[model samples]
Target: MFKDITPNQLFDLKQSKMTIVDVRSPKEFQDATIPGAINMPLFSDEERSVIGTIYKLEGQEAAKDLGLKICAKKLPEYIEAFKQLPQPLTVFCWRGGMRSKTVATVLDLMNIHVTKLSGGIKAYRNWIKEQLDTLPLPELFVLNGCTGSGKTHMLHTLEKEGYPVIELERMASHRGSIFGHIGRKPLNQRTFDLVLGEALLTLKNAPYIVIEGESSRIGKIKIPDRFYQHKEASHQYVIALPIAQRIELILAEYQPEIHHDQFIEAFSIIKRRIHTPVAHRIDEALKNHNYREAIRDLLDYYYDPRYRHTLNYNEEQMTTFKVTSIEDALAKLRAILPALHVF
Candidate 1:
């Protein structure tokens, strides 16, 4: 027999051995879903639209009859797919509606017991909002720096070394810059919230979490207000690197040669903001494939000037680190973890 569980209960089972199956239409699943949940849509986009239109125009009975007809032909395929998934499973739809109920009922009849998400994805979304609003986050150790200072790389390295770290940029799929979206597809707000909520819960018991300093927005996604407030008030470690090293790091990470067209497009967006002479210089450098010169000009004229005014720390709350390389930075940071008593 299948069992029904609330959204809170489902979250409590996140560390357990189970799979979450989203049975909404493909488009619905694509829009947002629980982290790590697999898409096992009950209907294709068109089929769902037809069913919805029938329910609105012809009534529920007609829509049910059509849905039954569609399901009958697909029963064998659905059974095979469900059987292949790792179980015991938890299934959900938009509102714990017909789709999930149908899946649970059918699987049960086949002697495959499963748990149903009581109010489905909609309820889970509400739960996520509540968690973000009220959850007590661990103290944050914010890493602050200008572009190409390797803050993102440091966050991942700290995480690998057993330090709790929240990678906001990775979660948002953006680097929090004008050129942030060049090679990466940004996550919509809903997907960003989903991943962030999961990360917060996963590290709920940690002593503290290390994070890169960022503006409230990463690409188009906005950080939740409560979390951003904590980040603003946290102690910051400012990373200082030489201009030559910063340019080298940027070139290695972005590979402007491979994304030449994208770089041109990004430059177009900021053309009016930059001085005409400097902007023309960058344009000429790009056309001549002198990426290093273009990058230096942008950093010196555009990024560094903008970054200086955004620094939000006092002497008492901030520490500065001057490192020759990423490895040197990592070593210095790791050494401080012991002093901070994080271990």
Candidate 2:
């Protein structure tokens, strides 16, 4: 018999060599899933839709019969896939129901030691939510800068130098702006929570953490209220750089990922702030593959204007680093932090 393991047990399994298999539909796996689980979906999206329709109109028995028929031919393939995996493995479906059980049973009969998640991905999700809700976050230090100031680059530099940092943009899969959606799709809320929970758990013992300043929302995901409140009240370092240098940095970071249509779409977000003629000029620049001109124009006319007026940093909680180069900026920050006591 396959071992029936709880969600807590799944966490323990994660620390071992066992591979976590998600047997839900691929679409379901994509929307949200256990953080390190690999998708080995028992049903494709279309198959799931068909099964759902059958279940709704013809009832459970008919749906089960059809599902069995659909899956019967795939048994050899399933066995081959499972055989390739190490003997000790774990599996789950949406609710730890038939799909995972069938796989686990088949494997167990083949003398493959398989563990089935008792409550499935749903249980793991609940565990993640609870962990996030009660998460003990480190003392957060937000790194603030205007658009094009190379804040993310600075964070990466700090991380390489052994500073404790959690990149909110990486976790959310968006860079935290209108154009942030470029190059990556936003993770759904549940998936975001799982990633965030894992990050917080890893950093719980750190004395302090460096993070980027962000609004309550990053792309489609909302920051947890507690974490956001902590960021709002915590100390912050502001990085200021020459506008020309900033534009160069911004252009370098986004240029590779920019598509003509995407560049146009991003600028269109600020159409209300730009004169129609200026907007047309930006559009023409995009069409001509002159993204630098469009980037500079948008930053000057749109991002800078909006950001400059909105920043209301408290003198007591903020430190400013003004420099012409990234190295100078980082040096200033390093000098400000206590070598032994700071993270």
Candidate 3:
């Protein structure tokens, strides 16, 4: 059912110009799959649904008959699609099931040198699950501090210096909080995974990496569990600054025009948990130019309370380190990430 390529061999071929095909239906392909995989479904969503219903209501034999009919119809179209990628080709479906095997077998007969994923998409997803679960989390050094601490500004500074810093919230089109979304379309999940894959690829041999402290879900996208908990449990570093500097940082992050009722739409996600007094205070502050009061009050009533509740009750024990000044943060970081200081 497979080319008998070793994991390394298949993986090696996967790196460059190779054709990876997903034989699952369009809906499944849209949900998630390996990068660069083209959708050449052996069954469309409705076709698969009908076949499944027959299997449940009639019998396995009847379902197989229905599946064969769908496959025969699409077989030629499927072949044509693979023509676009002339290089080594591979095919996979949910469980290395009949659909993938059939397509793979057809291509193999044509002398395409095709490989079928051993366990199929199930295996790849399982691999992600395992890495997210058991792989000792990456060494996650965080850029943490209060609002004006310029944590994000520092991330850019570090990036310019050549350090690998993950601007996760920025990529997610969210600020990693309730009022995070500014309505731009977040990156598609496929692109998101591609970026994440690249980041993970870069960190493979590193001792540690610096990332911003973020909640599990940024806007609507959730971080993989393994990385989140790893950072949560790892040594934490705080990027600190004076109050005046922090205020400036705050203003820079959330702009004046953005302070209007439109944020209410985003914050609506947490309305149930928002206290009545806090809501009233926010409304009043929004009406007046009491932006400082509005922001601080929200932090005290909503943000601070929630963060405290999480930090205090969470089972993952974390060690704290402070970034007293930009120079100090850079100095401490330089010791661990020497190449980062080059910029």
The lDDT of each candidate is: 0.90, 0.83, 0.68
Q: State, as a TM-score between 0 and 1, how close model 2 is to the true structure.
A: 0.90
What lDDT score goes with residue 252 in model 1?
Answer: 89
lDDT of 1 at 165: 87
Provide the TM-score for each candidate, comma-separated.
0.97, 0.90, 0.70
Tens digit per residue, CA lDDT, model 3, 1-343: 3473332344456667778888899999887776668888888899899999999999999999988887788777777777667767888888877888888888877666788887887666555454435444456777655445566776877877767677887666667666665645565554454446545654566656778877778777877766777777766565545655555556667774565666655555665677887877776776675667767766667765665565542334443446556676677666665453321
> Could you say which candidate leads in TM-score?
1
- Model 1 quality (TM-score): 0.97
Task: Put down candidate 1 lDDT per residue, 27-84, tens digits, no spaces.
Answer: 9888888888999888899999999999999999999999999999999999999999
Q: Please give the lDDT score at residue 33 for candidate 2.
A: 82
lDDT of 3: 0.68
Q: Which sections of candidate 1 miss by over 4 Å?
A: 338-343
lDDT of 2 at 164: 78
Query: Ten residues in a row with the worst lDDT in model 3?
Result: 312-321
lDDT of 2 by residue, 1-343 (tens): 8899988777767767678888899989888888888888888999999999999999999999999998988878987898897657999998889999998998899888899998887888888778777877777878888898888988898888888788999889888888888778888888888888777776677888889998889988899888888898999888898888887887777673455578667767867668788878877777788767777787777787777775676899988888888888888877765464333
Residue pairs with clashing backbones, model 3: 144-239, 148-246
